[model samples]
Target: MTTGKEYVTAVFEKVKAQNSHEAEFLQAVEEVFDSLIPVFDKYPEYIEENILERLVEPERVLSFRVPWVDDRGQVQVNRGYRVQFSSAIGPYKGGLRFHPSVNQSIIKFLGFEQIFKNSLTGLPIGGGKGGSNFDPKGKSDNEVMRFTQSFMTELQKYIGPDIDVPAGDIGVGGREIGYLFGQYKRLNGYKNGVLTGKGLTYGGSLARTEATGYGAVYFAEQMLKARGEGFAGKTAVVSGSGNVAIYATEKLHALGAKVIAVSDSSGYVYDKEGINLETLKQLKEVERARIVKYTEHHPNAVFTPAGGDSIWTIKADLAFPCATQNELNAADAKALVANGVIAVTEGANMPSTLEAIEIFLEAGVSFGPAKAANAGGVAVSALEMAQNSQRTPWTFEEVDSKLYQIMKAIYTNSAAAAKEFGEEGNLVLGANIAGFLKVAQAMSAQGVV
Candidate 1:
């Protein structure tokens, strides 16, 4: 009889052999597999059913070429991908990323992580992800519109409201979603719920833009409360100057916590007296400028042209990694722990490396995994689908209240699962086990496909 650890190792080896060159995808698989030993011991039936094998492989992988014309009338080509990872629980639901770094491996890793994250939301939505290596930065509106329309022309064939609904991610925000949704509507004759994160005038949900950031802060608050601590006077450091980081700063301030720093890809801005939200909003949202410009608005703030992960070294009570995957590493984790950081909540997908997570756990830091912590965006996206189905738009307060409740529920369930599995305060194990159990039962009931 194979032991649980051995079984996990064998399954992981198969994954590695098949996806030898996909470093990001393999890393995600290994992280999730490391926490499943206890689960396998409790239920050997999952192994017999080959659930791990099926779960790792996407149900359908679509790849196509997106050809568009630039503003200068030059022809440009980009590769696009959509990985429908799972549909056992419900229809596939995830975001579409648009950046230069997007590839099959990144998409697959994100799609795989989506499976567990969506499951943790307790919403009737499966896991999937799609993206294109088309950078929207420095592109004119006409160029972006042309590219989005071309991308949607092919993507429309595989997505629908009841089949698979795509939302926005890193580079795909409201403007891009509007263009994509318009193209989908023109092609398929107005299926409003097919794509989420649409503009307010269209069938978009309120609070969708701030859901992920607010949700991360809410989860962090829960973690602090579990330890008899609160965010009354604590200082925070947030990475990234995008939607997640911006709104996280807003919510942190509202909760009485001072956010001293925020970063972009080029560098970070450190303000000892707390970041000015209005300046950040104008710089990142309106102007779409780099984070270093923040120092220009506030002369007292210091702009450090350092690496994206450098924010982790700042002495603070809370840390939120809202940047890209693997941005936070073991060394950064050590710095945060040494600085007496109380809790770390992820606002991005797989932002922290496995080793960084281990170091934090070893130091007794209250860590919230991305799957459980950053589920707010998708949760609100699901709510948007509901509103669309009912032909009703909810107010900001209504949507925010529901989002808070969902995030609170996620924390409660993760903590309860940790306690149940004899790993109290270990949210990584708790999130993985709790999320896996849901998908496993659904797969079992549906039987082999």
Candidate 2:
């Protein structure tokens, strides 16, 4: 009898051999594959159909060049990528990231993760991600506009609301999405649903900005309730001062938790008296300044440079790693556990390392994986699409209520799947198996497209 670990190792070895240079993609694959071993034991038909091999490969990969002129009249060039990883369930749906670090590996990894994340949403959407290597920081509004127009000039041919819908992620936000949508409309003409995360004046859905962050807190609340605990009086340390972290902190406060810390790429801010939400929003969303500037406004707060994994050392009852990929590792996990942290929820995609996840599971800490916890953003994106299709809009309260129900459903489904698979309460396994089974069954029914 082949042990689960041995089977997982075999599948992972094949993935590594094929994608030696795609480290990020391989990591995502390994994580999902590792969790599917128990399911494979129960359903040999999945192996017989070679679903692992099929799911690992993408349905399509598109790459193009983007050329635009800066304020200095100098022509600049960047690479753009769109990986439509899976459409087994519905049209391709994901966000478009714009950062200097954007690469094929990162895009593929994000797209691959989207498959399961979309599945967990219980919505009729598939997995896809698109982005470019163009860094939008420090660029004037016109410069950014010209670049987005150029990027959309090439991208407009491949995307539509029913085909692939792109939203905001990381460096891409309302400003960037606005530029992209404007250009797309100019070229394609009046397609409101083709892009998500739009301004409220347009087809953008309410509660979209707060979806991922709010959904994470809602999931955390459910996790706590499972253990006879709640967010009241708990201290939280949330890394990253971006939309996810900021709104997550806001929701935490509303739920009776004090978020003491939040970070950015440059460093993190620790406020012993609790983080001021308005101050954080001004720095991050309005001024667009570095997180270190937070201390200048709140004299009582202390700003510390971000050494590798230093944010994990902060003691708190709950930790939300809303930073980038692999930000939390085994060492960080150890520190969190040592600090008596009870729950760790991810607001960013794949923010926790596999080793760190192992540490949390071993210590019996409630860990909310990124796919399930962060699906709120994409879930609401789907809602925006529905509104566009119907030519109607939903109120903030209505959208938020629906988001809450979706998050609750995700937690319940994941928990039920985990219990069914003998890893009771292991969200990692629960999410992977539940999401995998959905996509796998869809793929099998579709006849291996």
Candidate 3:
């Protein structure tokens, strides 16, 4: 039998030999594998067929041109991608991001990460991710609508309820999902569950909007509970003003944490009054304004346009990075440590760079990796799939409570895996091993594809 180190080394060799992968994507995959060595030791068939080699790469990657017309009669074309990474346990499940950075490399990394994250959720959802390099930031509603419709027209061919179901991520939100779903329904007719994060008027479940953030907090709560602590008196600083950040702030407040700061791409607003959650929801969810504008409404809050770095400097017991990848780096991690931050939880995919994560781990903070912490969104998406399968909608409270339980269980399992591997408190190791074992077992039972 191949040793675990030999298996992991062979997997990395295969990864390095691949001609189609980008450096960032390869590095991300390598990081996950680096933490999954213990799991391979525990389950050796993963070494025989080299399951790691097969699973490290995506099963299929769909790239298409999304051409749309702007209101100015100008033609705009964007690159769209859907990477169905794995489907060992069930159908493909992930999110669709819409941003300038949505390239094959980034989407592949996210899809690869999703494979494990979905597995960790203990839900029968596989891993896939789709998105476009179309920036919806400065676009008009009509332009966005046209773009969404055009994108979905082609994407619908490759996705479905039982094939691949996608939800919102990053630049994509309710409006974008509405537009995509409208186009999808128009083409494929009214079959629910093809996409999650749908509008409630259609078939979206309750607590879906708040799942990622609330789930992160819920996972954090579990982590704290394991250590005889909780969020009751913690001060938190969260980054981003989008769906995840807003709801993360809301949940932190609900748990009695004073969420003192939240940011967007432009700037961050720090309020000593513990971040007015209602005011923030009105600004981002309703008004769709810049986060700096927050200080205009509340003169007491300090608005810093210095980006995520400013938020990292705030004194807090918890720091939740809910923005895009690499938003927090080594410098920011140092600043957070200087501020006496006790925990760093990722609400976005790889929000912290390698150096930042190393810093957090070395500091002995209760760090919750994105896969385990952010699995709430996909877990709830799986619940949405259940509702769709049964043709029945669960009440908001029911779904919310279910989400809470799943998050707790994920934390427990991930934490247990970490301890069993002799890497207690290292959730990065725990989550990767726990998630990998699930997918690997399913793949083993299904035989070689």
Candidate 4:
């Protein structure tokens, strides 16, 4: 019988051997494997088929060139990638990101993470991710529209409602989604469910924008409840001013927690009295100004451009890493713990490094892994798919209530799986084992495809 650590070690060595540049990927895989020891022991067949090895590698990787003319009428080319990591449980489903950091390695890591996240949500969507190195920040409306249309020209061939569906992520938010969906419709003539995160008039679900952040809080709420505490009266430090970070701050505030700081790639803003939501919305949504400008209105607040590390020194009861993968490291985790942080939840995929996760676990801080915590976004994406298939729309109240129920169920199922494997109170193990079992069983049922 192979010990779980031994199996994990072997898999890590194999992945490293395949691609030495995948250090970040290997590290993320190791964290999940370390948490899966008890599950491996319980389900010995996972060892027989070498599931860990298969899980780390994606099933398909698509790379293509996106060529578009800028306002100068000059043709500039960008590389795009899509990694359909797994379809064990259902069709391929995940978001399409548009950030300069996108690459095959990053997309592979994200898609691999998505497989478990989608499973944890108990949704019948598989795992996949697509994105380009296109930066939409400074591009004019026409430039962005043309680029998006060119991107979908090739992407539409690979995605469909019953095959692979894509939504929005990071730089690919509502505006980007609208462009991508419009291009898809132009190419394929309006297939309703081929994409999610659409404009509500085009079959998008309500409460989708708030799902991830709200879900993170809901999952954190569960973790707190287990420890005889809750979100009421806690102080939180959330990093990022994007959709995820903004909505997370909103939900935290709504739950009676004081969100003192919110950041952007430009910098972070600190308001001891808690951030003003309307000001933040104007900064992020309307003006698209840097977060540093936030301090102009509130002279008492501090702005730090270094983001995660910039605000780590501030004290808070909870920390939500909502920016990007591995944004919070060992030092940051130690800072939060030292400052009396009782809980940490990931609003971004693999936002916490292995060392940071270990630090939190050792400190007895309640941690909610990304798979269970950020599954809300994809859960609501699945909801959108349901609405599209039914040819109907749900009221905001109905959708919000369903989203809450889904989040609670995801938390309960992940927690129960953790306890069942004798790793009670360790959500890392629970989320991995629970998500793995679902995908593994689906793989078995599908018979080696």
Q: Best candidate, lDDT-wise?
A: 1
Q: Taking the candidates one at a time, how many backbone clashes does each contain? A: 0, 0, 0, 1
Quality of model 4 by C-alpha lDDT: 0.87
Each candidate's TM vs. the true structure? 0.99, 0.98, 0.97, 0.97
lDDT tens per residue, model 3, 25-93? 775787798898877787776788678888977899999999999999999899999999999988999
Using TM-score, rank the candidates from best to worst: 1, 2, 3, 4
List per-prediction Cα lDDT, in the order shown. Answer: 0.94, 0.93, 0.89, 0.87
Q: Between 1 and 2, whose lDDT is larger?
A: 1
lDDT measured at residue 47 in model 1 versus the true structure, 0 to 100: 81
In terms of TM-score, which candidate is stronger, 1 or 3? Answer: 1
* Candidate 3 runs further than 4 Å off: 19-21, 307-309
* Candidate 4 C-alpha lDDT tens digits along 1-449: 78776777788788888978866566666777777777667777877787777777788889999999999899989998888889788889999989998887788788888999999888899999999999998998889998999999999889999989999998998888999999998889989899999998888999999889888998898999999988888999998888888889999899999999988777788999999999999989999999999999999998877734567778999999899988888888888989999999999989898889889989999999998999989999999999999998998789878888888888888889888878788898888888888988877666655
Selected candidate, larger TM-score, 1 vs 4: 1
Deviation (Å) of 279 in candidate 4? 0.7
The TM-score measured for candidate 1 stands at 0.99
Question: What's model 3's TM-score?
Answer: 0.97
Worst 10 residues of 1 by lDDT: 304-313
- Of candidates 3 and 2, the better by TM-score: 2
lDDT of model 3 at residue 228?
A: 88
